[model samples]
Target: MTASASESGNTVAAVDLGSNSFHMVVARLQGGELRVVDRIKTMVRLGEGVDARGRLDPAVRERALEALDRFGQRLRGLPRGSVRVVGTNTLRVMRDAQGFQAAAESALGHGVEVVSGVEEARLIYLGVAHSLGDDGQRRLVVDIGGGSTELIVGEGVMPLHMDSLEMGCVRLARQCFPKGRYTPRALDRAALRVAQELEPVARRYHNAHWAQAVGASGTVRAVQAVLKGLDLSPDAITLDGLLRLRECLTRAGRESSLDLPGLDADRRPVFAGGVMVLLGVFQGLGIQRMVASDGALREGVLHDLLGRMASRDVRDQAITAMMARYHVDAEQANRVSGTARHLFGQVRRAWGLDDEAEAWLRWAAETHEIGLDIAHGSYHRHGEYLARHSDLSGFSSQDQAVLAALIRCHRRKISRKALDAVPDNRRLRVERLIPLLRLATVLHRSRLDDALPAVALRRRDDRLDLRFPAGWLEAHPLTRADLAEESTALKRLGLALRVR
Candidate 1:
């Protein structure tokens, strides 16, 4: 749901559940700009908790819950939609992520969404781009996180190219320097590993020829600080300065004994790993110098939240793009969407649905036929597959799952198994929306400009009563026959559909 100005209270918050740290930023909207109000961060090191089985360790879960409890105190009493919480790489890989997400939500008192790597790169770019003053020249942004690194090239606020590599400070540190002993051999091997990961996209990023390079993330920030403290660069990170720092780090021998100026105690353990990753990036991408940005993923999420509250949501754009790409029949989509929205207005209160549900319904109605481009046979299944697995920006994993379920259930028999695939907490909500979408699609099956009759709908428990203008059904025999079949299909799912 998009929050309006009044509902937003001119206050907003964003939480980033990163692999190594959990960060929360609270900002106030004033004069059409976000002003930082408060910030909190914790070194959760969530990536360390995942075992070979992909299960989050119980101790690690407790630590995360405890940290969230602290963050929850500051977030208390904020209206829903005023705050957005997102999880990054670790949560994306966990096998039992659903159970962990539920517990985390309970502790934080807000919904948690897991985003794709590409989406993560986009948000990071947005945050970094917004932090710097506008410059017409193209810029390259790099973010080295605990479990992944994102590289984005863009001009101004719009990102043109984004790629995420699966190498990070935490993962690399654990793999090469597990005991905090950073031997030259281990550092060389780590750098070599990162180079291999970047091989596929190195040429493209180098060829983009961005006028300037910017870095965003704790790793990059620390690197800039160390260089400045040592009077190496005095400003930004240069290739020469990084080479000097790398020499110092390798000679320090162990993370515990390293006494580098401007290095934070919390950052020391991961310093070598982060430095090696940056070294690899600079070497592979042919970057000469890079400056650090004050913003990161949490800041990007806040800006995105502001956009949604102001009704300029990117999700709407993503849906429109998908529709155009699939060659959806706009007229038919509009007909179905209009009918679905009209029906939704009548029964939303009874079904306990809000604007968010309405948004999903409208998107589902518009893109329901996306799979027809592939083949007309079982197009619903094809649409479901695309929606579920595609790297759709501005949408969380949960949002995609719900969308896939709605499209899957739009035609043919509404399978119990299909509904069960939706998140447990959201199953009932999708169940309620399925019938409305089905009825709307059936009403517009002829794909003509024919106007639909005024229809009234009511809900009581699991039963639905649909009332059309008198004699309207008799005038539309095909629609009447479709409704008869729909009624029987709904009955199998224990929903009584009574039409008059």
Candidate 2:
């Protein structure tokens, strides 16, 4: 669901749950143009608490919730789907992530989505590109976060290549600058680690690929500021200034002693780590200088959300591409899609579905047979795997789970485990959705476009009565057997499928 300017909410807010800080941006869309209204950021150092078991420490968890409590209050009165809260790095790799996500959503009064690292690079590019507003120069955008760093090279607003590396401020600082102490040896070791991280992808993002270099997010901006404070390359980050800053840090010998212009107290602990990454990036990518941008993940999310509100959803394009890639039978997919939509109209209200459900049905109908390219036997499972694991731009992890579940249970015995994979709140609606998709596929098993008689569907709680034209079932024995088999499958999901 996307927010629209036509709706009561001309105001849209994007909240970025970063490992280092929680940032929120509220913008108003008026006459198709976005205007910034409010922005707030709070440092939480969430990555610091991730243990070997992948759990957030209890104290860190409490601190995170407290920060979310404040963010949620600011988002008060915003309509659902208008406020987008995205989690990066920490949330993506955390153990029991679903549990934390649910609690976070409760506090924020909005759904929270964790994007893949590659997707994170894409969003960061979206934000930086929009801020720059397409100068026609190919640019390399770099964003260093607490637990990860993203490098994106793009022309105008479209990113051509992207990479997200494991090196980040918090993780690296903990490794190389513990107790806020940075020695010459420690800095060199950190530089080496950053090099190894970039070794494979550095060439692809080197100077030859992009005409200009731009940095986004907190760490990069801080580095740009510190260079000016020291009066060493006051305009942008030059390699010489970065090296000078490294020397300054080694001379201080401790985070407490290091003092420079534009270095905030909160940043001191992780400052050395961020600088080391910048140094390695410069050396590895042959960068002479780099400037900073006001845009980052939060802004990118706003623009992406705006695109969604305007109905330019990237997920639609992703589904279309998947269909072509997997060699789906276009005609058969069309038949199933049409029937599913038809069935949906009858049961939507009764089953508590909305526009989002319609979208799920359409996508499921179009891509249901994708697994046929892999093999006919258990094609449903193959389709599920594709939906579950593929990097479908703009589809959240929860969104993928829902799509996967629908495809998995479209035929044969419904996979209870597949349905269970869907988030708790939306599980029931997906269960109801499965039977409708199954019915569509069952009706079109012959894969002929000869057109069947109009079928009417009525729903009463968990029971769905599917009525065909008079004598239609008797005339089509094969479809009847298909429905009989479907009835058994529906029983497992606690749904009744009565065909008369």
Candidate 3:
């Protein structure tokens, strides 16, 4: 896909490969607001397909692929950046997720991003905040998926505290109610286990922090429906209402034979387990009531896409925050960014680098020195550590990996092994961009505002030829020597850099 196609689309779509269900939302941008045009959701029970060994069952893989094929049909003709697809907890935990991801991408005709749990929490908050309107009240948003539960506290659209618990409905169901029977003992065990999981973060989410509690995801929506249908709660999910629903489930005994009011047949299988998780959340966090939100990860994804299209990307804000936290030199960062952008423009077309690549490069260039905050010695490694492990909002797991790789290799010795560690499809791009970043950084090593002479860069197969104006190299002998040394480093990575 061309850069133009990615940036110039009115229609956008988001696909969430959730643990229990796969969901896709297509929205149209009109009057600066997203209008939902289509939504598709299918219960694939993706979490249930993973065994104790974390390997995805073949049958489950087939179900997931079939579902993606269907989603692919709806997503056809969407521009490259017009669509964003994310894989959640089940894919995160799968031992062989790469295999599934590759197949899924093929089925969907787009790349799939596997986001970190904290990032997932942020997206959930974004969805909930946009859906609930801008009341300016701090909210506690909880999302219970098939394999994980995300808890977030935020005001407006910014998430202040976020956490992703390892427990979820499908996981709890598999562990405690494998036989499909909802015995009191099983319910007790599930709730107790969930409570134990929430114990550490319970105090952080107590009533004092947030104005109101909100729930997003199918489990909570189903629970709210059941509560209203049973007349336990008219418009909200309350502790007492959840307890009553628990009693009814216990009375029903088995999930398959159980019939409940306002419960969809599709949700019946995981309904009991979902209730157990919500019960744990309510009891552990001391939440009296939680109102359901119509939006979730999918909506959040769309809104984030919109932000990117509108140049209000949270990622830029996140990078800025990181810079502030690390005390990065803004002037130096801007210099490096400017130099990198100039170099990128010279070779982007030849190297097939898109706007996304340029964006990553610019962000890396701006924040590559973050590790200096920790210590000057081996700061690049420190920077890489922070970039890879930190809970950076708006960045997917893959984004972190690539960004970290670039930072790790931005200075000192450039290692092919480090570049090889990046995602398979992105290795070449990282390799191409690393030299550009290194050159840019080297040019600004003096941190001076002196005007730089125009330099030309051309790529020929595995070789990069760099030509500077006459006498520029001699006038800047230090830069010349740096370029000479960089040539050797490039050779180690199987690339030839010719400086003239």
Candidate 4:
């Protein structure tokens, strides 16, 4: 679910369950500016031992749960809509994320959103752009995490291109130097390997492409500290600084004996791996100087939540754009949205539906016919695909999945199997919303410029009765026919629809 906007926007929080660390920032909104009130972070290294088969190790899971429990305690008494939680690359790779996400969300006060790689890059760019001055330079922002690397090219508040690659400090450390030993040959091999991985990404990020390069995340901060210690450059990382740092570190040959100033002990094991990744980035992209950006994905999530609280909801705009692109009739969509919301209000409590579930149904109703431009047949399927894959700006990946499923089930034989395939928590929600969508479609089948009759809802053991005004259904023959057809549609879901 996106988020319920609070009319009196007071406070907002964002929790980033990152691969290398977990962070929570709570802030108060005053005079349209965010004032930081509280901040917390822990070096969980959550991506530490996720294997090729997408299983999180037992130790890693325990660490993540303990950290989330602590965060949960801190989030006590916060309003429901005030906090937004997001999971980064590690959650993206976890095959069984339900157990962990459920536990985490229980500790926190809201559901956890595991976004796509591109979405992560987009948020990182947003945080960077908001933090920095309006220098008007097209910047290349890099965030190397525990399991993924995000590269974004943008200027001002907009991003032109964004990509997330499978390269990071924790993953690299495990693959290259599992014993925490620093050797010239080992470092050389790691850097070359990272460079090789970048071969596909380097061509697109050539020097001519972006004016300035900015680094984000802990890996970059450690590199900056090592460079500042060497008296090389306090503001930006240079190629010479990297080469010199590698030489000095190689002399020590082990993490324990490294004599670099400002190197935190917690960062020791992954420091060598981070440096090698940086060296590869410099060599592959010809980057001479790179500065660190304090802002990252977590802050961007907060800003996005704030936008929703205001009236400028991006999901609404995205729906309008999708309808326009697919040539869905605006009048019909409005009609459906009206009926869907009316029906939702009628049975929300009976069906165990919440505000978030209601909002999703409304969104689906407004854009269900979005694939008619492709072809009328299987348009629902096409629309589902578009909703699933499109770069929907305001929606998290989970939001997209729910919206797409609602659309897919709107006209088809009620796909109980498909509903089962979704996350368990959402299966019942989809089941409940599909009936509302189907009924709304039936009410608006005439597609006429006329208002629908006031309807009431009543629930039986396993069936629903959609009662229209006493004589309204009898007077409208076409609506009667539509209801008859709807009966067949509802029957497929083991549900019976009665028209009164």
Q: Which candidate number maximizes TM-score?
A: 2
Sorted by TM-score (best first), the order is: 2, 1, 3, 4
lDDT over C-alpha atoms for residue 328 of model 3 = 99
Between prediction 2 and prediction 3, the one with superior lDDT is: 3
**lDDT of each candidate versus the true structure:** 0.89, 0.89, 0.90, 0.83
Model 1 Cα lDDT, one tens digit per residue, 286-392: 99899899988998999988888779999998899899889999999999999999999999888789998999999999989999988999999999988888777
Residue runs of model 3 more than 4 Å from their true location after superposition: 1-9
- C-alpha lDDT of candidate 2 relative to the true structure: 0.89
Name model 4 segments beyond 4 Å from true: 1-9, 183-185, 254-257, 324-329, 348-355, 446-462, 469-478, 491-495
Residues 341-365 of candidate 2: C-alpha lDDT, one tens digit per residue: 9999998888789998898889998
Candidate 3 structure quality by residue, lDDT tens digits, 71-184: 987787787888999999998899988889889999998999999999899999999999998798888999999999999999998889999999888998999999999888
lDDT of model 3, residue 457: 84
- Model 4 lDDT tens row, 238-329: 98999888887689898788878878888887888788888888888889989999888888888878877775666787788888877888
Clashing pairs in 3: none
The segments of candidate 1 whose C-alpha lies over 4 angstroms from its true place after superposition are: 1-8
Error of 1 at 186 (Å): 1.4
Q: What does candidate 2 score on TM? A: 0.96
